[model samples]
Target: MDLFQPSPSAHPGPELPELLPLGPDGIVVRFGRVVSPQLSAAVLAFEQAVQENLPDGVTEVAPSLSSVLVRFDPARGRRDQVLTALRKLLGGVDWLAETLPPASRIWHVPVCFGADQAPDLKTFCQLAGLSSEQAIAQITQTPLRVLAIGFAPGQPYLGYLPPAWDIPRRAALTPQVPAGALVAALRQLVLFNHASPTGWFQIGETAFRPFQRDRTVPFALKSGDSVQFHAIGSAEYSALKNRSDGLGGARYEAGA
Candidate 1:
């Protein structure tokens, strides 16, 4: 027997999600208008469910900060049929109550937050009304969650800093921040996976490379993972930077 019978007209319940079509073969299931842990959890749960019990014709499922993007094989399934299947799947679960997907790890990343390593540290401290040591202490003391991966390949958006640390992006963009640059803004921190322009305040730099194209697993971190940043000195940073193995002296623990 089929796991689920397709309804002639799929109607979403009170907690119904908004289904927005993307191009011809994609659909975005938006859980809420804003980003939150609950929304992220819901999106990830729905993403996992879709990946595990994909209806006919779905090709890929990608989770975002607050939504899931499902791609379909147009030749194999009509849009309406896919939508019906997705609606049924969405209605089947209590999204808000869903737990985060497993295999989440805690990564201890070594960062050099000295003035030479972090060009914007002074500015960041000025804005946050903290001394350099205080700023570093505040950042390093907290373990941040991997909220979403975007902006660059393997670049993770980690966050939920205390309200006092909720700083805004710079008015102008820095020409470019190299890979492994630790930047922060709006209560979230982003470790740059590759050189890119950014408006976020560059607070530190890590030798750890999260994105290794040649490696079997290109991305070292995933959404729902925890990241704890620890301060390191120039000598250690240089030593780790010279190593060719490519993990950049970062350590990982299985459970978060």
Candidate 2:
């Protein structure tokens, strides 16, 4: 069965936080099929809980939009043993009601949303029924949470912009977008850490380097961190283009 999908025949019980094997050495703890802040909270809480109380053989815990992937060492323990430990841990608390962890950091990243930096800006503005200026205002006005970091090293998925921005991903792919490209779709924004092909519309560009191998912490943004984007002129973006610091033109606070 497709473990990720909701199949009544595959899982008849009403109990949630379901467990499905992800192969011999991994298990997927699914909170639900939908993606929302509350679900994300549960995933984060469970991830933290697992980290604090891992059974033998468990090697890693990674949280995604609505689930946690628990990987383990097959030689250390059997899947049933790990499942038993997870079941016990899951029973210890009501994870669904758990609040998000405290914000670890806050970032104010600068972006240039103009035509030159963002070639697809006009296209997206048209689709959202927004003018160029209006689009920039909407995107920069609020701070989005760093929901998850994937697709590329240190790349962040940030979102839940107003409903009007709840657009779908493009039908066709854009051959390539450079590192630091800011794209939008599904009411979320993705800040690319490296050049890549994508289906999301390119709406802006930033100088921030989310991943820097030279840094002690290669990934700049952690999952629970907050990020607010501010607009910058072309000249300013040019000035901040490639500074020694990997932050580009972004500034951050230690704690939320």
Which residue pairs collide in model 2, if any? none
Poorly placed runs, candidate 1 (over 4 Å): 1-13, 92-103
TM-score of each: 0.84, 0.84
Report the C-alpha lDDT of model 1 over 1-256, residue by residue, as the tens digit. 2313333345444466778888989988888887766777788778878877898998888778888888999999988888878887887567987766763688998999877789998988788888888888878998787777887788888876767667778889999998888987777888887888999888899988888898777788877788889999989998999877568989889983
Worst 10 residues of 2 by lDDT: 2-11
Model 2 lDDT tens row, 109-146:
99997677899888887888988888888889977888
